[model samples]
Target: MNKINIVLADDELLFLQGLKAILGNEEHINILFDAKDGDHLIQQLRDAKTLPEIVVTDLKMPGLNGVEVTKIIHKEFPNIKVIALTSYFSKPFILNMISIGAVAYLAKNSTPALMIKTIEEVSKKGFHYDEQVMKYVHESITNPKDKKTKSTFDANYFTKREIEVLELICKQHTTADIGEKLFISPRTVEGHRNNLLLKTEAKNVAGLVIYALKNKMVSIENDSL
Candidate 1:
């Protein structure tokens, strides 16, 4: 199998270096580029001959934050997966990043092993969340009420079952696992997943997760609903 290409963007020099060093140790990943901010990230992409499989970015930066960078990345290279690395687990932060097209949300303090696991998982499964984020999520579940409305992103693309499948996918269950959990056959799970990718117009599981996250169809917070 080919190495998974990765681009990393973060404003803090020390943190950036640490992440680079940690991810560098992973034999399965290849660091394609590193950037200090969104502008530099874009410039790096322009300079690169080929796109990477994933872009791990810090949520807060000097110029363009991770959310804006994610939106830009999706607009330009819709195939690349965006993962948000942040210190805060605020609801707004998580929702906004998801809204912009992020496949994974992880706390900055997460272990190196967890980070590596998240990257690998999102690469295959499309989304991953650390325990911290999951805790925040479980704490925030209230009855679904419309507090505010932004321009609704296009969720008309996916069928209800497809959406259901995508959510289960994000929850990090395998096809067989999801089938057992949802009382569906593994073959049916696979079919719904394929249809989910088609309807979401995403090339891979990461893209599908990004679509689900950005459209608010799936929440990073422990969604009991």
Candidate 2:
């Protein structure tokens, strides 16, 4: 099995060490590096021989801070997913992180098991949101800002099969699961997913779900997972 390489960034030394100890115990998780501040984290990323698959970072850090680092990573290293591990658990914090390209958000008090599960899910699905985060996403979609322009859906914009694939995706189905349910190969599912991303101009799978919800193409009560 391929190990999930990860970087951890937090200003609290005790907390950072604790995280290292916990994640280091997992066989499939490789702790590539740890940073005490956001600036250090960015430097590590720049100088590293192998970049990590995920960055688990605390929101409030010394120097650059997590928000600034997340934005930089989003712009500079789009391939590396960021999981916000912060003390702030308010709706604004969650939504802001999501909008800034964090693939997952976790409270600092969250259980190690949940963190592990989140890391696994994000690695497999390209994103992961807990029930709380999902609720926030639905609420955000339902009550969009006045400045935000609503997206209109065109019936012919997406093929019937593509819609099927997209619906399954919004339900958080893995590629293999979507393939089995749709009677298609995993490669075919991936192809359709890529097409959906291209057509909608979404950066990732999470964006696809948001696009579907914003366009009223998928119902939150029925389609969200």
Candidate 3:
């Protein structure tokens, strides 16, 4: 079977190590590289002979966070997919990441299974997002005077799986948790989250949540976030 090549970038050494350990168990995944920050990730990408299929990254790092890393990766390797793993779920962050070309966004709370499942979906479909995240993101954003930007994730392009992912993301479930609930791998959940970020043009989880809320994609009237 063809294995999926992956790279991880995060500032927290312990967290990075823990994630690596979890991902190491997957048969189909191959971690090609790791970086302490976005700048290092870019340097590694530049120096490497082979490129990874996907990159899992933290949103906030010492220098050049996930969003910056994503911008570089998207520009240097348009074909490569990106997944943002973060603690913050704000609108600007989500929108920023989306603009930078990341395909998905997963919270640090996600589980290994969710990560795997999201990865599978992203590898196959090229995008994913938690349903709740999507709902919040859509709702938070409004007209930015750039009609072109408005048309970026105009609701029609989302698939069923992507929508589901978006919902969960908004709910703030970790990739692993979402995976377990959805009966998929954590990687797959990560992939789905990335797909949602890409579709909705969200920078981080917060941005996604705002987008969902602004667009009325997910309602906040009856439910509490």
lDDT of each: 0.77, 0.86, 0.77
- Candidate 2: tens digits of C-alpha lDDT, residues 51-113: 999999998776777778888999989999999998878776677778778999999999999
Q: What range of 10 consecutive residues in model 3 has the weakest lDDT sum?
A: 145-154
Deviation of model 3 at 104, angstroms: 0.8
Candidate 3 to truth, TM: 0.62
Cα lDDT of model 2 overall?
0.86
True-vs-predicted CA distance for residue 167, candidate 1, Å: 41
Please name the candidate that would achieve the greatest TM-score relative to the true structure: 2
For 66-148, candidate 3 gives per-residue lDDT tens digits of 66667678888888899988886655556556666877888788888888888877888898877865764575565552222
Q: What's model 2's lDDT at 186?
A: 100
**Model 3 residue 185 lDDT?**
92
Clashing residue pair totals per candidate (backbone < 3 A): 3, 0, 93
lDDT of 2 at 94: 77
How well does candidate 2 score on lDDT at residue 154? 19
